[model samples]
Target: PPRVRECVGPPLSAMAVQSTPVMLGAAGLCFYAASRTFTSPLVPSAAGAVPTPHLRAGSAAISADAPSTFSGVVPAVGLLAAAAAVAGGRAATSTTMRRAAKVKKKGVRVVEGKEIPWNIFSPKAPYEGKVIANHKHPHTLTEDTGDANWETSHVTFDHGGKVPYIEGQSIGVIAPGPDKKGETPAKIRLYSIASSAVGDNETSKTVSLCVKRVVEVDGKHANREVGEDKPDKAGTHFPDSKVYRGVCSNHICDVNVGDDVLITGPTGAEMLLPEDPEANIIMLATGTG
Candidate 1:
């Protein structure tokens, strides 16, 4: 018989488990308060009861011996409960709206034009342009001090003729060399153009892309202490791993000035700017959009 082994590692930690009880307690309190407010008015109304006297504005020294009825108490409690429910509901709605607003701020909002110019150049056949400049932007004072680094490159491609494009269009960039699978003919990646229609230098013969290098730490092949029972296949000790550089972004960022890059399509129409000059515009962007 073959030996079957059941391998188990460390137990997973649920960070959110601690907050569950607190959240349930608060919800239970709100429910209990609401239920009490609605059901407290169980007393019957007084028959042939005298209407409560309306107090005047400056009437001090009023009757202190006035009878208090159960009917009055019930209505008062009901009114208070209704007011509380309304106020709580409004507060919750306001909180929800604020959260949604914060999420919206993270994404870009654009008023687009009706016309969408499609496929001037396809992926099958792409236009080649010379890279005039490929350089990193000036780092902020705060960013210079931090260990967390983000490299943003401004790449300019010079198209011999005018490649007419709208404000919010994107262009395809083909990385040099084969993919990870050793496939020939590199994949085309679409990046949004940072420059205007007239180009960065106002020459109408060039375009630019604001590219951020995407570096991700691969944990699957991460270094771990070799077990006595399960030794490493290579019998070698590896140190803590480094991040894997993105293929397309690395190629774009590393391109020197005067290098020719494959370009395709002044594409996308959904983000084009509205023609109306006086229109209210709200643009939300993060790290160069």
Candidate 2:
């Protein structure tokens, strides 16, 4: 995971020179790292090199930087060939997003296939506090979870006009801007859903989130105390629980009613539930380390 953490702007000049190629970002096109390793970036800065002449054909989108491992001219020809392959269709230039927003104000038909990128819906938002209606349940109802297990914290939202999702997705909780005692943005984490679309038929679009508190253990011992007793009087019947020594979990655990929090998601992940009626499932998780 640490190896994949990187940035790709402003060319690097701190390493030994090899067959490195500089990468440039185009506003309209999608860009992603190919995960090529053992070697670093292919692009290098041509800070002092003289500018080359610009040339244009009738309808070709010229590439300014040469892709590493290959010569300048191949990518250009490849682009041309790809364009020709999708000449009539929008694949060469357009995506379903265009059909939904720009081209058709009436609305585009849901094609019922293929996955889109996570950034398309733009879930990123700033955390604004909200009031927790319950005395014990600190998490504000981000949406009606529709889970029968939790009626106290349940909430309802007309999610995206209709619920937008695929199974096995998770949501990211962006905790409130650091507590009054601290001065940093709250860390974000993910939670998976445990509900099935059983009675969710007509109107109320809903999703469930496994909401819990944050526990921070800054001291030597990472575990909670061996044993302790606490009482609960919220009438909700959930026990008075102590955080097990985690930073984010601790803060989350202390949430009071009427608190504001930020949430984003229904983002897809690699794990998926089996679709075949006869398929078997095996879940395995190790002990709490």
Candidate 3:
């Protein structure tokens, strides 16, 4: 773990280096803002850890000339420190943004007739014409096979989009549904991107989704129709004949060769892969929650 110990040092030092401006700015701003406002509404901030000052009727002109009597220094100092931390984090983010912009935006070169989205958001290319060609592998149900499902059921998307990704990314499949009420632009569901940049040309851009059908409850599907309709029960969301069944996997499960479907983004940071490639990944999941 010495390497880990070593890894932590520079960043901490950089943060300390970056804190100078932020800490000063915070202290100055707090002092400025409070100076204008009177003590009557000098609200105690939201930490709820401390009580606001109890002031006398005229509080001696409320001057900090008497440093002994002034108690605002503690909160002011804490606020300054928090501001510094935030600024340091922001600086790192800005640096990363610049780097990403500088790197080549990798993408799938369009091969056939279909367009594919390779952005960090939607990773999968929609099945162009109906009847998806190679679906021999629906979704790997390899429960405990010590298998890497990252490359399972992998289908390559035509390059026109970049698949630059880390270990854990979430993408949404843009599955268009019936144009019923409130059902346009399609709904998108987040799927964790399984593959890393393994340099494999074929399946590198492809992402995997581990999902199960959220079927309509028996009572729900069995509900009776309203107005001049059957007395049998039906599911939620009226116009039950059709509805907004999620965008990606649900559509994926039912994909036939060449179905004209839409796909959206890979938007999520929750399960982002660790920056340290040497870091061991420990995933804990309870029934795909």
Best by lDDT: 1
Ranking by TM-score: 1, 3, 2
Q: Each prediction's TM-score against the native?
A: 0.49, 0.37, 0.38
**Steric overlap count per candidate:** 0, 26, 32
lDDT of 2 by residue, 208-234 (tens): 443433232233433334333221112
Of the pair 2 and 3, which is ahead by lDDT?
A: 3
Off by over 4 Å in 1: 1-117, 134-149, 220-242, 286-289
Model 1 lDDT at residue 187: 85
In the range 1-289, model 3's lDDT, one tens digit per residue, is: 3554434355666666556567677768677556633444433345563545665444533333323332565666677677777877787777678768676544432224322334533334432322333243434342423221111233323223343444555555555653224465555655565444432334554434455433222233322233322211111232443222333444555444444444455445456555567999887876441
Weakest 10 consecutive residues of candidate 2 by summed lDDT:
15-24
Candidate 3 lDDT: 0.45
Q: For candidate 1, what is the lDDT?
A: 0.59
CA lDDT of every candidate: 0.59, 0.38, 0.45
Tens-place lDDT digits, model 1, residues 1-289: 9999998853333223333444454565566555543443222235565544433332333233534334455665566566656656665566568768677321133334244444566678788889885333321112222221255667788987535677888988888756555555678888998888878877788888877655444444212222211211112222343444456776776677788888888777667777888988888787642
| Segments in model 3 whose C-alpha atoms lie over 4 Å from true places | 1-161, 179-181, 198-203, 219-248
